[model samples]
Target: MHAKFEIFAAVAPGLELALRDEALERGFRKAKAAPGGVRFRGTWADVWRANLELRGASKVLARIGQFRVTHLAQLDKLARDFDWTRVMRPDVPVRVEVTCKRSKIYHEGAAAERIERALAEELGAPIDPDAQVVVKARIEDDTCTLSVDTSGELLHKRGHKVAVGKAPMRENMAALFLRQCGFDGQEPVLDPMCGSGTFVIEAAEMAMGLQAGRSRGFAFEQLATFDSNAFDALKSPAEPADLAWNFYGSDRNAGAIEMSAANADRASVGAVTHFRHCGTSEAERPQGPSGLVIVNPPYGGRIGDKKALYALYDALGRTLKQRFKGWRVGIITNEASLAKATGLRFKPTSAPVAHGGIKVTLYQTDAIT
Candidate 1:
């Protein structure tokens, strides 16, 4: 039987091209992009490696089944007919989220009700609205497709950052932003306002050839037919030779520095990055030459403190220009005007990342020529 899997990638909204390239590099030949997700076909091995190595993906889901239905009756039948036992654990509580768009199954409540009923009847698991296993329904153009949320929570909940202080960016988002800045292991990386050290930690981890999934578990393990032996064999080896720590991080807040040190220690990435405390204006470039510098500073958009943030971005821009020449830069935020204050040539790639209810884009700039 040809195994069908859903490999989801983090896209930069208008920059689907970037995401496409990442998918192709992962041995996914027929990669196609959709709104908020990507659909691709691969084998069990592909699924394992994609989950293990693909940095751009937020989650890798196996499309257990999909059906087209026009009426409520068909929706009920489809959910009941799916081999739920093959994928979902009977003991685990599950949640259903439904979306309707240009379809006859227009009632969201009815759709959720039908599926929830099927799962309860078949599995005898009570429906907890905030359960671990989530079943998603999408109705578009008279077709209703059902997918099990394989990675229960986002993959960025990478299990290590228990001491997440300040505004911590997701690991999945940090990885994509690093790729957006052309990180190829050949360049030095830096995050000036490295709160909780997400960017720096991700960079250091990648540089050390560490598996992102090694530190955490996924929803797939709870499902039936999840081969523990297959998955365990894919994990990167723990023992490795010493490598260079080209990634660096700094923050002005003393508490942030302390928190980052602890977070990085838990993450086992102290060998990959150097953490320091310094204001953006007084921050110094690394000892090496040109590399990428990324920062996900607070925009004050969600909290209504944009004025003080403007000063911070201003100081950051001057630091990059004065210390690091011909170095690529990336800034993730919801505020475009705040990013424009940096005075660097920014390519506004609309990032489909929602942090603290703030959907934003990463404004990146090329090296000064």
Candidate 2:
């Protein structure tokens, strides 16, 4: 475990730039956007901080070591020769995942088996398929790059949200979508179709200066190199700002409203988050200045008939345009016609992002006059 190593923050494929921006804003060194993630150079402390603070990352991986290997035997011998004790404890269990592309070792199962054998037989580490700690080995073009997953569960878990509505938006994706909508946490945010309150809660947390991982634990805590005291020091107490505006969420389903309120309470943002049971047509602007109105309404791919959703989008657009003057809007959907149905003058849409196996795009509008 060197003082510094290459760290990668994995995000959804279309959100690499947003993650890169977040990384750079957090002062990560040499944060560069790639196809699926952002790469940076930092120490173990940086890795811990990234897992704690980055809201857009799905996982943080520490690139521990790499080597050029042509065959399975070479990988096995090298895995055995590597100093596992430097980063992992023998008592803790770990699972090895292997992916091969244009490499001599094409069999992923065999490669994983060899790595597992090396850890079990050579290093005396227990191998479990369900272990929280993961060792990712990517054999690409005959080069083996070894990395460890520092965030145990997906970062989207957030650990506090236990209840969810049908086809709920993931917390990580919600946060990035907020960023894409130019939300800076200084203004009010209302999600008209706030299922499970992800967008509202995330906006409230950001406004309060709360860390995304405040209520969660990380897999790095189980690693041999993790320093408890140092990590503890990194968790500076959150001194929430005195916010002037509040976050709002409205849903037609009473169950959704209940779930949103409960999740907001669990996340410690209940004071600033307000959830109400109301339909999109009934949504009205808050008392304060107009801010961002972001919504993840149901589309044809996720729920209901495509024909029925057009009226829903039409109603939502009519409500926003009529009631929320000077407020910007963001709508996420898979269908272009659905977005067009809103009748809001939207700027060009963002790149397509994979959500629940369907590609969705964020259609945003300038402030309504």
For residues 78-183, could you state the per-residue lDDT of candidate 1 as single tens digits? 8888778877778888899899999988999999999999999977778998887788888888787777666766777777887776567878768877876788
lDDT of each: 0.77, 0.93
| Stretches > 4 Å off in candidate 2 | none
Would you list the clashing residue pairs of candidate 2?
none
TM-score of each: 0.89, 0.98
- Model 2 per-residue lDDT tens digits across residues 214-299: 88999999999999999999885866567899999999999999999999999989989999999999997999888999999889
* Location of the lowest summed lDDT over 10 successive residues in candidate 1: 7-16
Residue ranges of candidate 1 with Cα displaced over 4 Å? 5-16, 123-126, 347-354
Clash count of each predicted structure: 1, 0
